[model samples]
Target: MSSLILGIESSCDETGVALVRLPDGGAVPQLLSHALHSQIDMHRAYGGVVPELASRDHIRRVLPLTEHVLKESGTTLQDVDVVAFTRGPGLAGALLVGAGVACALGAALDRPVLGVHHLEGHLLSPFLSEDPPEFPFIALLVSGGHTQLMRVDGVGDYAILGETIDDAAGEAFDKSAKLMGLPYPGGPELSRLAEGGDPEAFKLPRPLLHSGDLDFSFAGLKTAVLTQAKKLGDDLEARKADLAASTQAAIVDVLVRKTLTALKDTGMRRVVVAGGVGANKLLRAQLNAACAKRQIRVHYPELHLCTDNGAMIAMAAAMRLQAGREQAEKTYAFDVKPRWPLDSLK
Candidate 1:
């Protein structure tokens, strides 16, 4: 018999739900339906996400989104055999909304429930793509709150090779963009502006590039952007595109070099890039070129899957369920880990 799983993700500003069907003895999983609600407009005025607002918005959207997924999948809630949700490493209030909804639904249905790690969901997202990487690959997770490299030996077996000591790569992009007067969630906006600008126009430091460790640091890079912006004076907007281009180039340079180094250090021929920054065109291009030169394979989630979404959460839950991973007990009530470490989970 086939098993259907309902997955909910509210790790950040996005509320996502996906229904995945696991077939009997199948090598690949099937994606039934998925829905995502972005809170970009809600948080745009504030220049970034506010946890309380994000949590409230999630509560309002999750159920409807779940309904949409079920309807689109042509499956009723009663047919769902398992419930999955993102448990931690995100906003405490946000995680609670997902956890509460998932647990409640699971209990009402008398089904098992699993709490997934947000980063793990990102790491496994590539598997949902057409060309999935083989086992024992390296993963570079670069998002708003994190930047890390890991060695994935198998399902649920993740080894942290290196990570950021300061602000994450995505944070750097957003911060730099803000310094250039870009709006909230400036990372993508910054990348767009970078298209017409000369990447070499500004000389920005690649923080910790020579640290000799896989660990990264972008706080200094952000400072460099700030300094440059201040020097540009009142006409900062006129040079905004160029500034964006230069900043992005600096960041991509460091990320590409470090990822290549990690691949070489671990002797892993396959690499998977995840998180919001994974969508950066420059980073993707550079990584592709670098990996091609070394005959190393690179994997990425579909563009839509690159960001925080429910499909990754659902897919990850399916894998854990198949592996017989422990389930959250009915009485097990927990909150989010605002600072959960991926290594700690491992």
Candidate 2:
């Protein structure tokens, strides 16, 4: 029998809700509908997320978004077989909002509740795409402030290969953009400006390019951008685009090379890139070219699903059920983990 899974995501600055149908006989789940509300505009004035504000906003958005998803999917709340939520590695207050709401709904309906690891949601997000990857692929996970490479043998079977020692790729992008006076959500803004500049115009460091291990380091690169920006001083505005391009190039170069190294070491011919940075056009193009040259398949989540969303959470929950890796419990006395580790899921 098929089951309806309702998911809520309030891990950070976005409130997302989605509905997915878990088919019988272990088939891939189908996403019926999803909704997302970004706090970018509200956070823009502060230059970053305010945890308290994020929590309050989730309280206001989660139920509404869930209603919208159910309406769009032509389903009722009573039909939901399970309620899933992001339980952490996020803002403490923000996470509690999601966990509390999910458990409350589950209790009211007497449905089981599942708490999903945030990174696992990202890792499994590619399955929601039209071209889903098979098992035993190299996974490049690049979310906010976290960069990791893992060997995914199957659902719930993951081994970490490498991770960032200091700043992650997203931080390098956003920090560099800030140094160059870019606005809030600097990563995408920097990428857009890069389109008009010469990537080779500014020479930047590619940290740990030949570290002999799959580990990554971007703190040095971020420092280099700051130094270069200061040197440009009066001409910084005029050459900002060049700096943006150079910064993006440095980050992407490191990511692509490291991913390729992971594939070589694991002997995996397929790769799945997930998380927010996976939406980067330059990263996708370069990975595609390099993977195609090696006759390796590269998979990514649909662009719209790249950021934090309910679809990934619901999808993760459904997959775990199908794989028998986890069971949705009836206990609604929930707690949130604000600093959970991905590899610890095993």
Candidate 3:
């Protein structure tokens, strides 16, 4: 029997709702419709997300977004068999908004609800793309505050190959951009500014690039960016673009080199890059070029799905259910895990 899964995501600054059809006989789920409302404009004044404000906005948007998704998908609440929500490693208040709505809806419809790990949603996001990857590939999962490379053998089977010790790559980008006086959501802005600047203009550190292990460290790199910006002093304004370029280059270099190391060690020809940073133009170009020379295959989620979204959450739940890796429960006593680890799923 087929089932319609409704997914909700409010783990941070965005509220997203999506519906997917889980077919019988182990096929990949089909995304029916999805909607996202970003809180960027509302939070720009604060420079970053405010937990209380995010939660309130989610409360105002989730239901309307859900209605919009259902209307677009040509479905109704009665058709939904499972409800899924992002259950963590995010602001506690933001997570609760998603959890509360999902559980309440599940109870109202008398359907089962599934709580999905946020990282797991990102890990499996590529399956929603036109060309989904097979099992046993290397995965570079880079989301907010999290940078990890994992060996994904199958659903629920993951082995962490490496991870950040202090600041993640996303942190490096955002922090460095902030130092340069970029606007909020600095990563993308930094990358945009880098297009016209010379990447070789400034010397930057690639932390742990030669550690003989896959582990990553970007805290030192961030510090280096700050030091360089200060040294520029009055000239910082004129060289901001150059600094952004150099910073982005350093981060991308470390990521590409490390990912290549992982490929060599595992002998896996297939790689999947997911998460917010996966949408980076330079990262995509470099990875594509490198993988092509190696005669290896690379896959990525569609740009829209690269960020935190309800589609990934719903897709993750559907895949888990298909693999018999998890079971949705009728109990609606939903609780959010603000610090859940992806390794815990194993």
Candidate 4:
């Protein structure tokens, strides 16, 4: 058997391809090569991803990206033992592009295929880092569309601690940024602007900060940001940085506190953060500082892997196969799940 896993990810605005070599015997898999194409610039003018355009771009990017990954890995399609792709909780059209291509390739190569859950890929992404996390850690999954706390015991063993009831942490960031007239992908832009201003410059609500449970709600926070911007009125532009700082502070505060509450409740001493928002420096710094005070180890995906990427998908698949949590299928007929829950993989 080739023991090479090929992963494709087109769940949203990014197209990614990667190759991972599952180690002989029972060692962990190693990432070989991966390539990604971001559609952020393309969607900037529109303020968000357009589903049809994203699907078309995935078609144009996946194959060439796959070729690049194979070439960089010193391998070819013939060496692939399994093909994996993000199968859901995303735009249906975009999901189809990756699922269709992955299935077609699997059929052509006579290799089995596995449909990896998108969030599961994110949750397991830290394993690709140099300081990979051990099993049985608490996970905080914060991204553009989702915010969740999970207890991961093993490859397919996950228990969601709590999830967002309304707006997620990322959504809170983006919407707050939009109110400040930041760029389309507003979260990072807002975070950047926030650096120059005092986080206490404006008072923002930390929604659900004391709700007494892990459930998150950021919708009210976004409303507070909008109100603050309107109050600034003609001076909004000059004071935008302050607003950004305050917004980020509110979101980060809620996330950090809730995460700590989860840790306290579970009595676990280690936490792993994954997904796009995991790349935010403020969140990372706060989490690190907080965890340090409690002697809890905090792990994160490599900065590059913090976003949707091929390496995590491939690594997740390899781990699943290694643990016998799932079996690769030779069947080529496949479908995408635009709303699959991460814990459903169990």
lDDT of each: 0.89, 0.94, 0.93, 0.93
lDDT of 4 by residue, 221-318 (tens): 99888888889999998998888988999999999999999999999999999999999999999999999999999999999999998888899999
lDDT of 2 by residue, 1-346 (tens): 8999999999999999999999998889999999999999999998888999999999999998999999999999999999999998899999999999999999999999999988999999999999999998999999767999999998899999999999988888888888888998999999999998889998899999999999999999999999999999999999988899889999999999999999999899999999999999999999999999999999999999999999999999999999999999999999999998888885
| Pick by TM-score: 1 or 4, better one | 4
Give lDDT tens digits, candidate 3, residues 1-346.
8999999999999899999999998888999999999999999898888899999999999999999999999989999999999999799999999999999999999999999988899999999999999998999998667999999999999999999999888988888889999999889999999998999999898999999999999999999999999999999999998999999999999999999999999999999999999999999999999999999999999999998899999999999999999999999997899998788795
If the candidates were sorted by their lDDT against the true structure, best first, what order would they fall in? 2, 3, 4, 1
TM-scores of all predicted structures: 0.97, 0.99, 0.99, 0.99
Off by over 4 Å in 2: none
TM value for model 4: 0.99
Q: How far is candidate 1 from the true structure (C-alpha RMSD, Å)?
A: 1.3
Q: Compare candidates 3 and 4 on lDDT and give the better one.
A: 3
Please, what are the lDDT tens digits per residue for candidate 1 over residues 1-346? 8888888999889999999887778466678999999999999999999999999999999999999999998889999988889987898899999999998898888888888899988998898899987888999999988999998887778888889899999999999989888898899999999999999999999987888989999999999999999999987888888889999999999999999999988888999999999999999999999999999999999999998999999888887766555554554465666667776653
Question: Weakest 10 consecutive residues, lDDT, candidate 1?
Answer: 325-334
